[model samples]
Target: RAFARSEVWDLLESCHLRCNPLGDAGVAELARGRQRRFLRHLDIAHSDVTDDGLTELSKSDRFPGLQSLEVGYGYSVRSPNAGPAFGPDGIAALLTTEQWALKRLHVSVVSDTPLAGRFEELRSRFADRLTIQQIGTDPHR
Candidate 1:
């Protein structure tokens, strides 16, 4: 279930579902379609999506009217055995997208890692528009 169903998410406007270990294929396609037609707020925390899946979702400026994307501690899917892998630097893609009207991107992953570097780049491009971009490590931040 790599894709989201437009029909299911269609009925539920304000979707608040826990991230499944198998990934939320339930709304993958609906998440990809013209967002204005269905969604307004989406809260995804502790999902099984790594930078790979996030990058896939942001293939284009597809999600319009989406104001927030809360990915809290959800980027732990990378292979720890690997030398370095922090969510595939998908922030760059998200920040650069023309249609990402994101306001709250809550990622609890520590900063100054690979993800931070990508965030810096994204900040440069979208300094004014970007808000609540909480980067950097936090013992409980």
Candidate 2:
């Protein structure tokens, strides 16, 4: 809910936006030009964003300047086949030149159900540049 765009707000050179219950506000702000310039690194840890929200955000061309992105994880309400994954499908919209500037990404998720497939997709898209750290109680097939 803190999406204000002003010179005062622009002074934020380095910011680490983390929220356990990060809503659409940050996503909406990023979609806008609020954090367009000064925000080089962003951390959206502990955010409960679903595939739908991630898909919407990935489609945006605003984060071209982003150098690093860190996505945290929690429980999800994903389907069985897809198994609540947040892999390449979610990030597919960003794998192009629009997100080519990203030097690194750090994701911590419990990839069970279909989440593993999503994770695998991400590894494929990112090629050797991806490092995944999956921690879940479910077995991996």
Candidate 3:
């Protein structure tokens, strides 16, 4: 279910590509959209995205109007092996970008990993503007 760059130009402001197999290429294309400035919420969770994909998304001024993001839902009950596709470096790349306006960032971190430590650090850095949360099981409950 990949969207053509031109096709999403108008109503892609709040995209939800979760578990749709949009891989890194799709994510990159979306991030590089001509209408990116109009994008507000982007959810790429449980897809085939990678660290480089996230890096591409973090490129200069890519998502200026983005507010909420949800990127790793591998742990969701739907697919245990689904993701955590992009790692801490990927997340760090986005956080380090300038003029970030994210209000919420939802991700999944394996309980015992260096990524968890990094997430704590990221949470502290964006505490004022971002609310990072680990998506829990029982999403419908």
Candidate 2's TM-score: 0.67
With a 3 Å backbone cut-off (N, CA, C), the pairs that clash in candidate 1 are 4-27, 4-28, 4-29
lDDT tens digits, residue span 20-117, model 3: 87787887777765556777887887777788987887774656778978777355455565546676787777767764544466665432223457
**All candidates' TM-scores?**
0.58, 0.67, 0.71
lDDT by residue (tens digit), candidate 2, 1-141: 454344464655455666556655556555565556555666775576555556666666655566666665655555334333245555555455354445466676665434556668767778755556667657655
Candidate number achieving the greatest lDDT relative to the actual structure: 3
The positional error of residue 70 in candidate 1, measured at the CA in angstroms, is 1.5
Indicate the residue-level lDDT of 27 in model 1.
36
In Å, residue 120's CA in model 3 sits off its true spot by 1.7
Model-by-model lDDT, in order?
Answer: 0.50, 0.58, 0.67
Residue-level lDDT for 51 in candidate 1: 62
RMSD of each: 4.8, 4.3, 4.3
Candidate 2 residue spans exceeding 4 A from truth:
4-9, 76-87, 97-103, 110-114, 137-141
> By TM-score, is 1 or 2 better?
2
